[model samples]
Target: MSGYFIYASLHQGRPALEIVDADSRQVCLQWEYGHSASQQTLPERDNPAVDELSESEIQRLFRRLLLLSCRQSLHGQDEPEQNS
Candidate 1:
């Protein structure tokens, strides 16, 4: 994974989050609830005809991504080693 991009939007009339991997161009995560309203900030608020996120929103996204990374790291440590 090179980098990540996270955005908030409405999915089926409900707020949702979409996280994508920049290198693989694959979605890594999606959260529909349990997050604060800050996660719902629209990307257009800071961009013109482009999806741009505000500074605070970007910070929140990065924080969430970091937390997710830490959690995944912990899980990875729990896995048994595999011999090729």
Candidate 2:
């Protein structure tokens, strides 16, 4: 079976995301958004052309990251308005 896994956490105090192959545990992609993204990044010592993804794919990934970040930020907060 073909599968994959995604993980997100802080790396050196910066936001880090990784996509790994389930079978080989190889990281297919790694992104560190940091405080801002001023340049494009590619897998270390790897050709970016071979791993190029569509624009939509990148957008979708960004959306997921935003959602996850929001969730993490709200992890300990209380929403009294929702109680009503």
The model with the greatest TM-score is 1
Root-mean-square deviation per candidate: 9.1, 12.8
Q: Which digits, one per residue and each the tens of the lDDT, describe model 2 over residues 1-84?
A: 334588989866556778775667887667664223533543343655524433444665678667645653575333333555
Local distance difference test, each candidate: 0.62, 0.57
The candidate 1 region of ten consecutive residues with least summed lDDT is 49-58
Query: What is the lDDT, from 0 to 100, of the residue 70 in candidate 2?
Result: 64
TM-score of 2: 0.38
Which segments of model 2 are wrong by more than 4 Å?
Answer: 35-84
- Residue pairs of candidate 2 with colliding backbone atoms: none
